[model samples]
Structures are given as C-alpha cells and as structure tokens.
Target: MNLLIAFLLTVLLMSGVWLWQRRSGRADWVDAFWAGSIGALAVFYAVFGDGAVEKRVLVALVAGTWSFRLTRHLAVRLAGHEQEDGRYQAMREHWGERAQFWLFVFFMGQALIAWLFSLPAWVVANDPSPAMNVWVILGVVVWFVSLAGESLADRQLSAFRRDPANRGKVCQVGLWRYSRHPNYFFEWLHWFSYPLIAMGAPFQWLAWLGPVLMLLFLYRVTGIPYTEKQSLKSRGDAYREYQRTTSAFIPWPPKD
Candidate 1:
C-alpha cells in the first residue's frame, strides 16, 4: 500500500508539473523533463529501496537502462519537432477552454500507468532474496533482448525517415519491414521479463496486469490506432500498402 501511495503521489506531482508547463506553452520542456524524471526515479529506487543488494542492484540496472534508452530515443525524435503528439493534441481539443485540466489528467494518468508497469521491479526489490538464480538470469536475458530489439527498431525507423530518398514513403526496410510497431511490440515483451523475475513473490502475478494493460493500450487504445490513423492521413496509399504487407505488432516475414 505504501508503494502504491508513493506511485500515486509521484504521478500527481508530475501531472501538476505537466499542467503548469502546458499552460505556459512549454510542452517541449515538459516532455524532456518527464523523460529525465523517469530516469531519476530509477536512481531513487536503487539508492533508497530497502532490499537485498543483489535485488536492488539488478532492479536499478535494468530499470535505468530501459528508462535511459527510451528517454534518449524520444528526445532525438522530438528534437526540432514543433508538433505536439496527436494523442495529447486530441486531449487538448477535448478540454476545450479547460485544456490545462485535461493535460493534467493525461500526463498524470501516464505517470500512474508507468508506476503500475514498474510494480514488479519494486516488489522484487522488496524481497529478501540475496542470491541470483535461474529466474534472474532469464529476466536479464529477456530484458537485454527486448531492449536491444526495441532500440534497433527505433534506429532503423529514424534512419529511414532521415533519408531524403525515402521522403513521403513508408519505411519497409530493416525491422520496420517485419512489424508496423516493432518498438511497441518489444516494449510489451520487455514487461513480461519483470514478472519472470518477480515470480513467487507475493502479489507478483498481478504484475501481469501491467503488460496486459499496455498491450491493450497499444492495440486498442492510444498507441497504434492513433498513430496509424495519422499515418494513413499523411501517407495515404503508401501507408495502406505497407499495412497490407506488414504485421501490426509482431515481427514476421512480410506477406509480400
């Protein structure tokens, strides 16, 4: 319960900050700050968690690596980009004249979701286990693979975007050729690694909810649906053709 409270408070505080920044027309700063804040929280958990050294250290290392990689990737993507994310922009519209209220809800909501997603790590760190075992080894391997796959997918997409010859064309090379949202797919896979580490710990099975929620969000809610709609609007026929040939979330050989 204490952990849940801590997560809620963190979310509320971050949401308030986001609302303030959005009202002040500082969305870029808000996004960057949120990324940095996530990295900082991983550090905080590492230093302050009252657990065995091995568990704390492992949680810190894996969480920090994931946070840092994601933050850096978003920073690069948003660099010199003036448009707000479509999801956020849609929220802004929904809020009408009270956009700040909705912005607060949106940002803070994600913070809470992030906290939930990270619960397994926190739970594992709270355990008294002193020795690394097979589960730990498996978790580490999954984390490494997921992290590498997601990062590589992002890099491939970014490189495609940067090529002048590929302007206005759908990216169908490298990882992008196999999965429409390879990065998101790998991110979801990464969460399962947490449960593998925390298995047998009290309430640890509940951690499955985190990844399940994330998968639903990506497939049915705020992720691929919105992004692909925007893509279709912008890319038209090219994106449609790519969609027909490419898998949505999972990586596989292209049908074509």
Candidate 2:
C-alpha cells in the first residue's frame, strides 16, 4: 500500500505542477518528465523493494525498456511541434474558458491510470518467487516481438510521411498495409506479456486487466476511434478505402 501511495502521490504532484505551468505551453515537456519519473520509480522499486533479485531484475528490465522506448517515441514526435494533441485540443474547444480546469482533471486522471496500468510490474517485481520458469521465457519472447513490431510500424509510418509521393494517401505499405494501428496492436500484445511473466504469483490475474483496459481504451475510448475519425476527416475516401481493406487492431493479411 505504501508503494502504491508513493507512486500515486508522485504522479499527482507532478501532474499538478504541469497543470500550473500550462501557461508556459510545455505540455510535451511534462509528458517527457512523467515518463522519466516512471522509469526512475521502476528502478527504485527494483532495487529497494523487498523482492528477490531475479524478479526485480526482470521487472526492471521489461518496464524500463518499455518506458524508454515510448518516451523516446513521443519526445521525437512532439519535438518542435507546437500543436496540442488533438484529443486535448478538442477538449479545450469543447470546454472553452473552463478548459484549463478540465485539462487538470484529465492530467490527474492519466496519472491515476498510468499507476494502475503499471500495477502489474509492481506486483510482479514484489513477488517472492525466485524460480525461472517457462512463463518468464515466453514473456520475454512476447515482449521482444511486440517491441519489434511496434518499432517497425512506427518506422513504416514515418517513412510514408516523409515521402512526397505518399502525401494525402493512406499508408498501406509494410506493416501498415495489414493493420491500421499496428503500434497499438503491439502495445496491447506487450501488456499481455506481463501477465505471462507473472503467472502463479499473487494478483497475477489482475495483471490481465491492464491489457483489457488498454484495449478498451484503444478500441472504444481515446485511441483508434478518435484517431480514425480524425483520419477520415483529413483523408476522406482514401482512408475509408484503406479501412475496408485493412484490419483495425490486429495484424493479418490484407483483405482482397
């Protein structure tokens, strides 16, 4: 409980600071800071928490890798970009003058969600089990596969965007040809790896909730749905045609 409280307080306080500093227009910095802080906390827990060295090492390795990659990706994408995230910009427009308050609430909510989503890593790291098992090996393999898939998807999209020939056309080459949101698909797969690694440990089943909640958010909430709507508005018939031929969340052979 203390560990959880510490995590929550740290996130909330940092979010509050970001909220207060919104006047400076540094939301991206706040996002990067949050990621860095989470990475630091993972190391703290791995080293000082009352878990076996092996479990701590595993959790630290997985969580740190994920956090670093995600943070780097976001930082690269948002660097030198002044536009607010579309989701947040929409909220601002909807809320008008009260958008600041809503933004604070939203940031706080994200902080809470981040901590909740990270609970699997926390629990797994703190578990007493010291034995290496098949599940751990499987989890590592899944993590690598998901990481590679997501990286490839990001690269493919970046390359498509960079090519003038592909301007205004939907990306349908490489991984994007199969899944519209290959990055999101691999992200979901990555979470599943957590439960696999932590199987048989206490509260391990609860770890499954992380992936489910993530998929729900991605599919029904603020992920694919909003992004797709924006894409349809921007790309129109091209995006619609791509949608008809490509999977939304899963990677599979493109439809004929």
Candidate 3:
C-alpha cells in the first residue's frame, strides 16, 4: 500500500515538474525534484514502515540529510534562473523537434527511477532487528565516509570554479586531482551503505539495486559520459589530458 502510494506520488509530482519546467525552459529543475522526490519517498517509507523505532528514525535522518544536501546543491546551481544544465541542453538539441515529448518521457522515467532508488531506505526502515549489529554499524561508517568525501569533492570543485584564473582549466584540486569524478565515486559509494544497513532483512536484496543501478547509470548512462563530453567541449585538450592522467571513478594517485 505504501509502496503504491510512493510510486503514484512520484509520477504525479514529476509530471507537475515537467509542466513547470516546460514553462520555465529550465529542465534542470527535474534533477532537483528527482533528488528531492527520492529523499521524500525514503522519509515517507521510514516514517510509515513497521520497523524498529531506532532503525527507522536513523534511516529517516540519514536519508533526509543526504537528500537535503543534494537537493540544495542542485538548487543552488539553478539559482538566478540560469540556463538549463549542459546535459539537458545537449539532450534538447539532440532531440530537436520532438524534445518536449522526449523530455516528458524523460521526466516520467526519472519518477520511476526515484521510486526504485528509495527502496533501500524502505528496506532499512523496515528491518525487523531491534538491536544494532555489525551490518548497521558498518553501513553508518560507509555513509559517513561517503558523505564526507562527496562534500569535499563538491567543495573542491566549487572553490576551483570561484577563482577567475582557473576558468577553462580542469579542476585537479584536492580529490579532483586523484579522481576525475571523485564526486561520482562517492555518490556510488553512498548507495552501498543502504545494502549494508539492510543486510539481514528479508528484503535486503532490494537494497542492492541502489549501488548496482547507480554504477550502471554513472558509468554507462548519465554520469560520466555526459560530463566528460561537456568538459571536453568546454576545456578541449585540457580535459582530455586530465582524463588521460586521472582515474575516472576511483580516487587514486594520478598516473605519472
């Protein structure tokens, strides 16, 4: 029952967001709403699930904090009603005359994706275990490390962008110097925490979807390919050189 409602609510809200973006010409709003919807659905599950109070509450707080941080980050980028994200803009250009129709489809797809990703939170929130165990503790540790790493990556990128002298240059500062997409690596790492939290639950298998699907998306779909394409477009040879020397996903020393 709750799952059904979550799915319906996601589709409805994202449909509304589609209409809103259509009018504003800012498709990036969909990304913010998508992040928000997942968080909202995760919290909804955590609140309504019939699970141990401590576990449910912890899932709520952790998922909520992650959601809020991501949503706010995307929102800040959307401030001043700026142009659509380069990815979306490129998509629109590629889709051409049928862009609106495709965007509508894209928005609906995001709705489903958000609901799917929220399942980990649902599984964790509904864990029947009443006592803290190795899995839960491990999950929390993974979450902390991932959150800190991602935050640091974002800060490094933002600070790099802030310097006018760094304009048009690849961001090879802090974590960026190690991994070309350290933020993405950390985001993927964060998903594993959910499976860890849900380790012993009967529905624990569902939690695996978060990390598995996220990796697929990051590697083959939206994460790396688009960002790299855009970077190459903007930075040309500089980004190509960065790509040649830096690890694409994992944090590691630059290739000598």
Best by lDDT: 3
Q: Report the lDDT tens digits of candidate 2 across residue range 189-209.
A: 988877988888887887787
Candidate number that wins on lDDT, 2 or 3:
3
lDDT of 1 by residue, 1-256 (tens): 5466557667766866786675556454455556455555655665676767887788788878887888787777777577766666676677789887766766776677666666666766765666678887898899999999998998899889889998888888888989999999998888787677766666677657757977998899878998899999989998999899999999999996
- lDDT at 43 for candidate 3? 89
What residue runs in model 2 are displaced by over 4 Å at the alpha carbon?
26-38
- Leading candidate by TM-score: 3
Task: Indicate the worst ten consecutive residues by lDDT in candidate 2.
Answer: 25-34
Instruction: Note the residue pairs that clash in candidate 3.
Output: none
Model 1 local distance difference test score = 0.76
> Candidate 3 lDDT, tens digit per residue, 1-256?
9999999999999999989988999888888899999899988988899888878987887788888989998899788556787778988999999999999999999999999999999998888887778888998999999989998899889989989999899999899999999999999999998888878886999999999999999999999998998899999999989989999999999997
Whose TM-score is higher: candidate 2's or candidate 3's? 3
Every candidate's lDDT? 0.76, 0.80, 0.90
Clashing residue pairs in candidate 1 (N, C-alpha, C atoms within 3 angstroms): none
Give me candidate 3's TM-score against the actual structure.
Answer: 0.97
